[model samples]
Target: MASHLLLMRHAKSSWDDSGLSDHERPLNKRGRRASGLVARTLVARGYAPDVIWSSDAARTLETAKRLIRIIPGAQTVHHNPALYHASANTMLTIMQRESEPGGRLMIMAHNPGMAELYNLITGHYHRFPTGACAVFKRIGKAPWHDPQSWRVVDMVLPRDLEAE
Candidate 1:
């Protein structure tokens, strides 16, 4: 059996109010446009997740909510407070807790955690710019935690699909 995980970075956020805590900042216009494009691309490619886990922060939540609404087969998007600014290790722990073993799982989060998690999986640098998504597909029945069990499937960036 094979499984896949989509690790994504929250879309671009507004920094107009420096007073707002990192968690309170919201996505800007470009962010919304870019994330929307990414969402449609996921649905079109049939790589939408069965379940989505997103950080509780405003930016991440907005991104996840928008994406989930359009993900072809998606039905639920959960906000996990633990995922807010969660580190790569915390993300790994979350993956280990899943009840299912072989379905697409999407994590909406921030970087350097998103980039860090990608590095942990591939042992290479892959820029996770805002609204970026990378998928890791399992080659065998091995569990999600086993790094050797997976390989890169596909990667898409907002800039890649956005209309200039």
Candidate 2:
């Protein structure tokens, strides 16, 4: 069975705030608004997944919570420490390990890795801005692996949602 992966970057975060590490920063007002829009879009598009995985960072966790609130009764949300600042390969490894039989997965993470994963799977350059989302569909396989096996279905930036 083919599985789908929805990779989302956490919404905007506070950089002006003092005394907060990159991982400790929380989402700002715009970030919260963006997340709400993303969540509504996902719900409108029927993108709810069997699992919602996110980085342990404050911002990512908060984004995941907001998403879940919009998608009530969704599968449990997990905060994986390994996802914090993880590379594309690391994220892939996590996906490969966590995927269940005929299950769908969504990942809420930061940039660089999210962009890298999108690029790796789609074989195209993608600048995933904050609150951007890339949807991938695995073809002809069950377990998620090998970037070549996934195909990009859609890439939506926060601006795209705003435009709609």
Candidate 3:
């Protein structure tokens, strides 16, 4: 059976608190709003994931919380410190290692890793802005690690949604 893979960058984060480390910074006001909008859009489009893998950073966790609240279909979210600013290979390895066999999976993380992953899978350059998601459809019984097995289905960007 086919499954869905969603790679999303965390929403815009606050740099207001200069004292706070990058990992400790939370989402900004615009980010919070964008998070809700993206979550709602995902549900409306029937793209909600069965499970979520997210970076343990404050922004990513906050984004995940917003998604969970809006999309009740997601089973659970696993936060991993290793995912924080991870490279594309690292993200792919962790995803393959932690993912369930056959179900929709979402990764809430940071870039340029997110963008790199999208490029690696689709063989095309894609801008993965904050609060943006790239949806891929995994063909039947294909390995998640195989780029040939997945096809880009959609690119959901907060900017486009905001303009609507």
Name the candidate that leads on TM-score: 3
Error of 1 at 3 (Å): 2.3
Clashes of each: 0, 0, 0
Candidate 2 stretches greater than 4 Å from native: 99-102
What tens-digit string does per-residue lDDT give for candidate 2 at 55-101? 99999999888888888667778889999988899998986786453
Task: Output the worst ten-in-a-row residue range by lDDT, candidate 2.
Answer: 95-104
| TM-scores of the models, in the order given | 0.91, 0.92, 0.95
Worst 10 residues of 1 by lDDT: 94-103
* Candidate 3 Cα outliers beyond 4 Å, as residue runs: 99-101
List lDDT for all candidates, in order.
0.84, 0.82, 0.88
Ranking by lDDT: 3, 1, 2
Model number with the top lDDT: 3
Candidate 1's C-alpha runs over 4 A off are none
* lDDT string, candidate 3, 38-63, tens digits: 99898888888778889999999999
Number of clashes in model 3? Answer: 0
